[model samples]
Target: MNKAPLITKMLPRKNSLRNGGELDTKQLLAALMAFRRGDFSARLPEDWTGVAGKIADTFNDVIRTNQRMTQELGRIVRVVGKEGRITQRAALSDVSESWGDAIGCINVLIEDLLRPTSEMARVIGAVAKGNLSETMASEIEGQPLKGEFLRTAKTVN
Candidate 1:
């Protein structure tokens, strides 16, 4: 019942070129989704398990930082300016910038999380090259964030 070899063998018969030569982005996205949601715990690949754990840790840290930013922005919002007027514009701008910084931080974390995974890039590149069919594209497009990244990539191309 060594499923790894069994699965590997079956994939080639399924789509030799697409599976072996260039992985479908849909498959990769599915894998990533499962990994993130802890759905693939039983059959987690060794390499991916290590990377995913680190990514999860970083994700938690980023979320905590975002919470702190929100609290600080809330305090700023409560401040009043001269003539007893609430500094609405300044407060709004500060809140916006704080949220933007949180977004930037999350984006940086994403880059770090993905930078070590050449496999992800390769799969996405395959999708970019039109190797995946419409059904596969749809599945990947349904994945959160994956769709937006793919759309942005398409726009750039």
Candidate 2:
């Protein structure tokens, strides 16, 4: 079996490479390989028109969105780690719609974690002023605080 025929059939014609309207397969392959190696900066030439241009644009958009998400997540981790609480909520304006659930979950986690701590601080402050009857404001009927937080509130009370 002559492998030359099979190899020739798999490759684009030489004329196709020089065609001004066609995508440069070599460049596209390099960009894709770079992306696969975790280099999000790789991008196909935007000058290529038609579907090729659209595909490149879409890939670039995905890379940019992913980079933004990674940076934002790092910022969140640093803020929470250094300050011991989430100071600012993650910005959702530029984030993709697929991340909406994750953003909402993070916000909820921040609120849940801080709410009990804030209530404890307030109760402790009130007690420190000789008002021993003070208790956590979160000790309501339907929205009772949970587990360790409830026990903390009881101890403070």
Candidate 3:
């Protein structure tokens, strides 16, 4: 029996399959869902890699801003002003509120940065855990929790 060609019989591919540029939301969402299920390289748009770094940088900035605000609030709390520190306390509270807002901003930025990569990394890392060699595991276990990885040791002698 002469059947229609196999290619003709097959269903049409999605838009991403036909197009050759940035993946749309559906594709990204599918990839994210796939990432949740198992390991898969979450392909990013060429511009995405750059954008991720920027988001991380912004997150860092927010953290720094929070720290600075906290320190400034502490200083304000210590000040001996003629208004009996009420004004200073109020100002410090405002700064603390601002710090809270900054933290929220950082949360949003982190979510943006993590959109797909976090899931991808989680899936990949989980897969890696299952496939780790004893030697690699030993190396990781043995590696000093110091040097570049330890923030507390920033001023190591």
Candidate of highest TM-score: 2
Deviation of model 2 at 122, angstroms: 0.8
* Per-residue lDDT over 63-100 for candidate 3, one digit per residue giving the tens place of the 0 to 100 score: 44545665654564465233333323322233456566
Question: What's the TM-score of each model vs. the native?
Answer: 0.24, 0.64, 0.24
TM-score of 1: 0.24
User: How well is each residue in 1-157 modelled by candidate 2, as lDDT tens digits?
Assistant: 7799998886657525333446677787898888788787888777876655666688788777767777777778778756776567766566656787778888777778777888888888988898988777646436788899888877877
Ranked by lDDT, the better of candidates 1 and 2 is: 2
Best by lDDT: 2
Candidate with more favorable, higher TM-score: 1 or 3: 3
lDDT of each: 0.44, 0.74, 0.42
List runs of model 3 lying over 4 Å from the truth. Answer: 1-49, 80-86, 89-157
Model 1 residue 1 lDDT score: 64
Q: How accurate is candidate 3 locally (lDDT)?
A: 0.42
Candidate 3 positional error at 137, Å: 70
Model 2 Cα RMSD, 1 decimal: 6.3
Q: Flag the better candidate by lDDT, 2 or 3.
A: 2
* lDDT at position 33, candidate 2: 89
Candidate 2: misplaced stretches above 4 Å?
A: 1-38, 84-87, 137-142
